[model samples]
Target: MMTVIGGVDADRLLKDRHRAMWALGDYPALAAEVIAGLGPALVDAVGVHPGEHVLDVAAGSGNAAVPAALAGGRVVAADLTPALLEAGRRVAADRGVAVDWQEADAEALPFADGAFDVVMSCVGVMFAPHHATAAAELVRVARPGGRVGLLSWTPGGFIGQMFATMKPYAPPPPPGAQPPPLWGDEDHVRGLLGDAVTDVRVERRTLTVDAFATPEAFRDYFASHYGPTIAVRGAVSGEPERAAALDADLVDLARRADRGPVGGPTVLDWEYLLVTARVAGGSTA
Candidate 1:
């Protein structure tokens, strides 16, 4: 049974908020220009084959879905934000590929049990508030012996640190909401999928981001284009001093982590965790 507040399902309300938050950003641009390689990388790792039924959960703008379809698989890209789904549809259309784009919540996917040959999320699903529920959904929708792949930002990565930097100024998370970075922890994920999967493989990889020219560029871009950062900035927008402090801190973080030449482009190696495993035969619940 779902908890209800003011006649609305609490979880549904949260999902609605999440949908709006993601819709706030120019994520399609971010995915295409910066993190575009992630989807293909995860698809390659999962060995998505021709004619396979592939599902990309929390798939923002067809990151993995587009590539999976191009690999000759029938793909479905599911996300909470309709805007992102529309954007993904456009991308697929432009690529001359077909993908079934649907609005779906990662924690409660609208799919049958054992419905897909490949279930994956590239830097997606990790943002679902309830980690355990989302993990179970991932396993549940995969056919027995089907592959499950996930790519998430590590707790110690540049993106993780950015989240940490923003935490001080952000609003409190709802009850039962877990930190997104925990999905990057091997032990945490293993426990979440325990006994339901086998032949698990984990890899730590880095994505080199050089899109921003300087620390301020990184800060401003995030403020305008990243949903979470935009939300944080909005939260502090009314408080000018705190907002300025956040701006300064974000710039400082980028400056400290920048690996490029003393005065050239900003080079940041964002680390992430990649996990793939075969679903063990039997009922997934």
Candidate 2:
């Protein structure tokens, strides 16, 4: 007895789960708080200003974009998925804030040269066609005098452990799977930035995200929100049934998940990389 979600792949996986891909509620407010705390630390680090034209790339639901606009900057929120762009627009509107929402790919943008005074992306980009191209594109769109910023989850620390904790229940990742290092790791990110960044700094921060009222809640959250990860991954490569089976396996594993409280603060170890590099005309540094 097997069912499938049609043919899905990584892209399809995202497509299927875009709705569930949403960041948790209060995260938007929390994001603003994070920015506030890091804002002073990143003024020079990220070159943000009150009036700078900014683009929040992969700006799912405009959480960061709306706040940036409220801070008095003309902001545009862009993302690959039209669905996400639509969600972002609604969010901006709900907040009574005006923001330009656009559908664009990070690997290649349809904007003009030096289109933004400041370019920033949060929690997105690692899934792009190529991280190098995406990083370079950020530089390409920013004016030489402008700044490029990215906020990414720091890999292999508290956050890493969090993911690690869930790995057993996750669909088997590809072989030799090495996740890209995130912003918290300076040397790694610097290397990723190469010479494009004249200066770089990693501001480390963490927060307590509500884990779940019960393990079942966490399991259901992913089942509904994260999409059937296994099913989607298989469909991505055109093997729905395989993924479907894995999907069941995943849920089954979830039932066996550590039985704990229905509500508790699961401190998510996360890092927001606010590296502000003065755009160097011709490099990926």
Candidate 3:
């Protein structure tokens, strides 16, 4: 039986499942090692200044939030998964940076309008079920002239292809559900934020992840640590042959994209889009 919460659309129940999926594996452990460097880079790109109020939506393990706090901004790290939030708290504490952590939903942020000087999400908000609602919330929470920054995987990127590879094994998304990779498209982003902000800019960048000696080893690590991969693993668990075929396909894809064997370790280059925009009526500087 399907259940709806807070008068949300039936399809929106996927949010609950999404939450569960992320909670399965140790995302913080994996994210800390995988995308840690991108956090500070994104914070810098957003121009977070000292004394400004910064909100890191879907802040996994305080990656961007801790860096913002270190940059002298008052930071609030929010996410739907409590485990990830707890992990973020630990990270902030360990880094000796003060960050206010909150459990939050991106689509309908638990924040007042014009509440923050800067809002950001790094590979985070794109996962929200309702893209438009999430984009609006990101804009709505920013003060006029405030900046908003985001990073998302482009449809043509390695990560996007990886997602496509898992489609055969994973359950299909709800009908009409927007693809998360669409957030990486400049035109799609313009459509989403056009009315809310100005000076919108999008840039393509590459993020590299450490890979194991062989594609099979890399696939095993992702299958064990990554949320989506884990979900797919479970979905095909009962069917051994199907699971093997899916694994084989993913390994082949990895081999095709490999950019390693460079002495020490191999790496996979994942292309992502960086978006920066200013709330309408704000200083264009």
- TM-score-wise, the better of 1 and 2 is 1
Candidate 3 C-alpha error for residue 150, in Å:
0.4
Per-residue CA lDDT of model 2 for 84-197, tens digit only, reads 667667767887988998877776777887888888876655445346667788877887767777766566544344344445445564433235344456676677778776
Give me the runs in candidate 3 sitting further than 4 Å from their true place. 1-12, 262-264, 283-285
Clashes of 2: 11
**lDDT per residue, candidate 3, 1-285, as tens digits?**
345558776755677788888888778877787778888888989999999999999997888899999999999999988888988989998999999999988987899999999999998998887788899999999999999999888989988898888887888788656878888888988899987898887899998877477777878888888888899889999999999999999899888888888553657898999999899986665
Q: For model 1, name the residue pairs that clash.
A: none
Cα-based lDDT for every prediction: 0.93, 0.58, 0.87
Per-residue lDDT of 21 in model 2: 42
Question: For candidate 1, lDDT tens digit of each residue in 1-285?
Answer: 778899988988888888889988798998998899999999999999999999999999998999999999999999999999999999999999999999888988999999999999998899999999999999999999899999999999999899999999999998899999999999999999999999899999999999999999999888888898998999999999999999999999999999999786999999999999999995433
TM-score of each: 0.97, 0.67, 0.93
Best by TM-score: 1
Using lDDT, give the best candidate's number: 1
Q: Give the lDDT of residue 191 in candidate 1.
A: 98
The residue pairs that clash in candidate 3, if any, are 145-282
RMSD of each candidate? 2.0, 7.7, 2.5
